[model samples]
Target: MAGRIKDHLSIDCNDEGAYYVEARVNHPLREFLNHTDSSYVSQLLPAGATWTATTAGGYIAMIQVTTFACGGISLGAFLSHIIFDGPAATTFISSWAALTRKCGEEAGSPNFDASFVFPQSVAYPREATLSALFSPFLKKGICRSMRIVFDALAIDLLKVKTASSSVRDPTRVEVVSALLCKCIMATFKAKSGIQKSTLITHAVNLRQRAVPQFSKHSMGNFLCMAAALVRANKTGLDNLVCHLRKAIRKIDIDLITALQGDGGWLKYCECIKEIGKASHGTNDKIDLIVFSSWCNMGVYEIDFGWGKPTWVACAPKTKSKIEMVNMIFLMDSKMGNGIEAWVYLEEQHMAMLEQNQELLAFGILEQSPLNLIVS
Candidate 1:
């Protein structure tokens, strides 16, 4: 019933090297679907971290569609970030979902033209390079995560509080990213040698931002990083949101084009390396936070003929989700208009942040409710 999806994906990644497929029979769907610790991750996942692919088949991509005893279906896919970015992955998932709906030729085509526009001529050692950028803040630390859900009312109130007459309205992403950064930093304020500056890096969509623009169906890594640095005594996250708003707006097509031009990668890398290193993590350190917004990517819109997902959660594996310290993902709330912040922090940091009254005021903490499955 998953018409042309297998073929669609293969063609999408054809130039990336050999692709392999795998199918596995796993646990029943209800156990995974109904499981929970206050939220979804704890309920659905078995103990310890499990890879999206475990068959030891050297496949660049792996996918599975499992039918539940209750007549519901679950679709899972795994892809290395080196080959795809958030937008690219979203396009693929949406396309796959549309196909299953039998949306036909109108079910549509994806544009893998991102790479043709932004060539990967630079041989970036993906993991190593990222670790270098993430290390000072996250390396060798035990990371912990918990789901924090903001209700529609809290989100609306925050939008009002975060806005200023001086600055344009703060976006949902800017508001939430600012909130997490400020709250997390406040948790560490008493620590010795803590820096007063904070940096926020956001993953941006290049489809509409690219010159002349690319279709929403455009695939591959059409992504770039935008960093906002909050320096010394940034009174409130609301204030920081203004700075962040400006930084994100600066990421236009001219910038993307230049970053992709001749010697573009080198210049781009250098600017970023400096951004990470220049803070001079000396005795006085700077606080850094990275966030990506998946709020409107239509993850919950996925329906494999068993009704829309009751809940949509990122794959919160230890290696993939928790290992990246101080990283935050802002996604659409299962509830109508709010946002869910999947916060990954050092255990020590999480403890304090969880108790922050200011945060508690605006964001309700939803610890996963535990569930036992008879697997």
Candidate 2:
């Protein structure tokens, strides 16, 4: 493998291994892998990704470019999650695109000094302890991913429905999250015949939440979780939004400083442990749903000299213990006006969630025209 071979390679090998496959498509790219059913795209990803082959680690990341007979092309990336979160990962992709066209500002160095936020006195909990607490979610659930699209009209209508004198008005992310929260709660209630206390957690970006906001170039995971607890009967969208808003507003610099340095882990562990033990007696189990919005993360804007991506998504093989905790990743739609929610749920509840009337009313996948061209 010579560096000069980067332009293109012609390899002659018997098709007995997994790294490459030369295949033919019998239909249009969109029809074969429809936008409405994005889950199908995840199934074909493992072979298409360039996996890290060894610890010698020559590649921190791998890129796969696939061409279809209908002239459609798809770009996929396999990034090390240990090193990059959603925003950081998108930054890398965008920088590559900018370099391809030579049209963007010079890239700046990333900030890795975490001491700028947390003091040496602050201590984080042991990773093993945190993992043990959430192990219950990882042990027995079968995870499934489903893509839900909310066009611009549906988003506006949700805002209208959620606006009221009693209920606090919400942002697109808030209202949408609240709507999904209720849908899941309703599904659980209908299945169990009893209401249960549940938690909703959203991953909030800490860069903008800081006192003197951190630069966008600052790297590493700078995310804090904002959580709200909703009791059995108060699972209404309005109630959820209100609780969620309060939780988010409470994530000030004081909370960030405390959570990072001042015995935060000890208190958090005790709280979660006590909640779990207390719930064992009431015949009501706790359900946690986590949402992370990547709405303006610039992932959809990666052009790479071919064209902007028609669809961008995280491959399912990248799924980890986090999915078992029930998570949703909300991304900006290709059109830039709506949201696309990639929801990962336990297999048993997926059917019920898809059929959720209120969710269906808002999230209906709309197909976009694809342009097929060359590099």
Candidate 3:
């Protein structure tokens, strides 16, 4: 009976972000077997877990099981980016810890009915429509091989330097994004040797699309991105920041209102088609696609009566070729405030990033902890 799977449940924190937990028998590697009870499992979570909290949007956390030298007990949890975005994932993990401690409970029972919480039925159009929008761009084939790199201290330093500049506040998400955007733009320009107007499309979430007090806990992809134009000749960091801010701001209430109405989804599709047409098969119009470094891997609160996790990271399988740089942040260690970024890019562009090392710095991890542990 113990070996049988009991629950495969996903819970939304009080903040309305989603997380999943699964219980399984502990493997033979556990050393402290038969010593700890379920309550001990709960205590181990807060002590050993760490999270990379994002500033952009949702609550995201990555939980890792470092030492599982206990009984045959294990649990897993996942915080999806669609529901909590990035910022909310972090808040959910911290809040879950607080809630668990306050109740003096061992893994609080989760409210896991996605029908009521996410409600895929009434949320939007059918799956076909959503699939049409998200279908991978395979017409030309994936162009570049991707590699992920992380340089915690180096990225932080860049943030500090960019913040000191007069153009924009030195916030972690914005400044880092701006820097990465510039890096990619430079790489494309240097490699392709074509200088035309280009744009960096920033994916913006539309959670407050129609509903003002829209519950952050809603589980779905209520998100969209706006392209911030950058001239091929623009070289300065401030210019990138200014255009990014403007592009982000442009996707305001009017844009959301226009997109969410009846048949709005189709209109949105047409808009993308139009842009694709405008690009005219040239890298001039929108050369780079960039998103903030954020993901929610429920690391801190997933306690399955084992010791806390020692390492956690994003899955390496998640690769991109639309742009040279795609980044996501992870917690440095348990009980640490610093974050490490995993950047995916092509080898050629990566060399350029290294050449301009003063502007950007990164180190490749041996392997992605997420892929290692989860898969």
Q: TM-score for every candidate vs. truth?
A: 0.79, 0.76, 0.56
Clashing pairs counted in every model:
9, 1, 25
Per lDDT, the best of the predicted structures is 1
By lDDT rank, best first, the candidates go 1, 2, 3
> What tens-digit string does per-residue lDDT give for candidate 1 at 177-260?
777787888877745445477777887887778777877777665666677778768748678788787778888867877877
Location of the lowest summed lDDT over 10 successive residues in candidate 1: 1-10
What is the Å distance of residue 211 in model 3 from its true position?
5.6
Model 2 lDDT tens row, 176-202: 898889988887777777777877777
Give lDDT: candidate 2, residue 332.
Answer: 79
Candidates 1 and 3, the one with greater lDDT: 1
Candidate rank order under TM-score: 1, 2, 3
Q: Give per-residue CA lDDT, model 3, range 1-375, as digits (tens).
A: 001111122223445422333333344433332222111333333222222222233334334333333434333334433344543444454446546556435332332232342333333444324333433211222233223333446456655565534554644445556666666667767887865565465556555444453444444445565666676677466666667767777767776667654556655666555444544445334454445444333454443234455443343322233322333333343333334444455656656765665443543333343432332
Say which prediction, candidate 1 or candidate 3, comes out ahead on TM-score: 1
Quote the lDDT for 55 in model 1: 28
**Distance from true position, residue 353, model 3, in Å?**
3.3
Q: Candidate 3 regions off by >4 Å?
A: 1-128, 134-160, 163-167, 208-211, 270-286, 295-311, 318-339, 359-375
